[model samples]
Structure formats: C-alpha cells, structure tokens
Target: MELTWLELFIIVLASFRLTRLLVYDQITQFIRSPFFDEVEEEDEFGQKETYLVPKNRGIRGFFGQLLSCHWCTGVWCAIFICALFFVYYSIAFPLLLVLAVAGLASIIEVIVQKWLED
Candidate 1:
C-alpha cells in the first residue's frame, strides 16, 4: 500500500509520542545515573561532591546505549522508515522537505532550551 507524506509524518510523530510516554522514567533514570558514579561525601566547602559518570560504549555497547536512548532511537527509526518509504515511492523532494523541517525545528528547540535555561 502507498502512504502520503502527511500520513508518514503523523505515524512517526505519534510513535515518538507514545514511546516517550512509556519510557519517561527509564529515560530520566538513565540521565540521572551519571551522578551516582561519584563518591558521595562532603567537600571542603561543606557541600556535596559529585562526579559525572563517563559511559563507555564500544561497538555493540554503542548500539545498545543508543537503543536505550528512547527518543533518539524513535527518531532514528522514524527517519530510516521514512527514507525507505521515499525510496519505494522514488520521491526525493518530500524527504528533503521533511528533513529541512526537522532541522528548523531542532534549531528552534535549542534556542528555546537556551532561553529557558537563562
């Protein structure tokens, strides 16, 4: 069966949203795990000292870590599937347009995040 660009966009977006909801806590814990790698003790300033965990990823480990990064994995899968769809339909412009929009959105998101952090 043939699918339109809009349909593909909806499918990918919806899949990402669903996976996000399901994996939120695991994702959060994965993010927070780095803090635990340090020796939890008092600093000279009487505050806590912590160190960031350096994750080691080699070959299979790299792919495993990537697979565990839920949102990134979702986006990667979605892009691959969209690329396959484009190849099947022999439509280059639509894929390029989608990638362009994604890039714009990423830039906007980075700007918004920076603003929020300030």
Candidate 2:
C-alpha cells in the first residue's frame, strides 16, 4: 500500500463520522450526565451558577463544539497524517487512509453546521 496525503485525509474524515454516528450519542449522554456538570462563580461576589463543561472524549464531541470541533479535528488529523507519512511506509498507508476518513468527516460536520445555522 502506498501512503498518500489524499488517502490519509479520507480515512480520518471517515473515522470522524463513524465515531460520531456510532459513539457520540452515548458519549454525549455521559458528558451531559449530572456528574459532568459543575457549579462555578462569575465574580468574587460569590454569585454561583451552573455550567455544562463538555468532557474531552475525542470524537465523541462530534457536533458538540460546532466549528471549533471541526477545525480542531481537521488540524489534528492533518498533523497526525503528516507525522505518519514520515514514520513508516507500511503503517503510513493505512494511517493515511484512516486520516482521510476523519478529514471527510470533518468536512461533513462543517457542512452540517452551516445548514443548521440557516
């Protein structure tokens, strides 16, 4: 198998989507669980308020963080693919394929976000 940037990008994108479809909902439930929520103060006045701080469960955040997630996944996938490219030829090809799937997933996520906004 030949390692190529395009292939890697496709793999990552696909992984991202699969992760979201297959895993995000369950993870989101866990994240939104009462345990994940915490109270915080706005100022020294001791005004307390509850906030939902999302847990970092990798692809679980899928559509959770919106554009930020898309960008983060995209950038991260690209970097990892590049690194793998320089690592091992055998692993590089497979890794690139995975990264490519993830990359495609990110693109789809971005598109969905835009549609939602409209």
Candidate 3:
C-alpha cells in the first residue's frame, strides 16, 4: 500500500521513538543490568562523557548487547511496528500518529537544545 508523506514520516519517527524508549527508558529497567554503573568517558574532542553499561559476559550477554545498541533494537522495533501497522491498519494508525507527533517534537527539542547550547 502506498503511504502518504506524513504517514511515512510518522513511521520513521515512531520507529526512532520506540527504539529510544526500549533502549533507554525506565520501563525496561528490569532487563538492564542492575550492577551496571556509569563511568566517565572521554571523546575525541576530550569532552568528558558518561554512560551506564553492563559488564559483558559471553553467551548470556545477548540481551545486554541488544538493549544497548539502537541499531539492533531499532530493527526489531521497526519490524514490530510495521507489522502492527499492516495487520491492524485502521486500529493502529491513530496510536502511531500520536507517537509520530511525539517523536517529531522530541527530535525538535533535542536540536533546539543543541543550538541553544552553542
């Protein structure tokens, strides 16, 4: 089926938002490592950064790796969202629409904050 520009945009935005939520939000905290801690990291620019990461353990470390990388989780999220959109087009569109709006707003918020910082 053909998608309108807005619909396409919504799909992209929803995928992005869902990926971030699953990877970073407190709602999925249970799946994250409880013992993980944030440590100071330095970038190429020498700017100090911090990130909370779990220690890697082979075989059992799949979930930790999955939840940490947006590219990995985003692929799954996009597939699920797209399947839901196709299977329940009429029922899911409104919810997807709302998520798209929220996602766009959040992205704009981030860009604005970055601009203001500079």
Q: Which regions of candidate 1 deviate over 4 angstroms?
A: 1-6, 13-55, 90-118
Per-residue lDDT of model 1, residues 2-115, tens digit only: 778776665565445434533344545564454233446788899997643324655545544554567676777567656665565456545545654654565578799999
Q: What are the per-residue Cα lDDT tens digits for candidate 2 across 24-51?
A: 4454455335324354758677777776
lDDT of each: 0.56, 0.54, 0.82
lDDT of 2: 0.54
Cα lDDT tens digits, model 3, 1-118, are 8878877788889898888888887887766755355689899999999887755676436666777788999999899889878899999888888878888888899999999999
Which model, 2 or 3, shows the larger lDDT? 3
- Candidate 2 segments whose C-alpha is farther than 4 A from its true place: 1-39, 43-80
Q: Give the best candidate by lDDT.
A: 3
TM-score of each: 0.34, 0.36, 0.73
Candidate 3: misplaced stretches above 4 Å? 31-60
The TM-score leader among the candidates is 3
Better of 1 and 3 by TM-score: 3
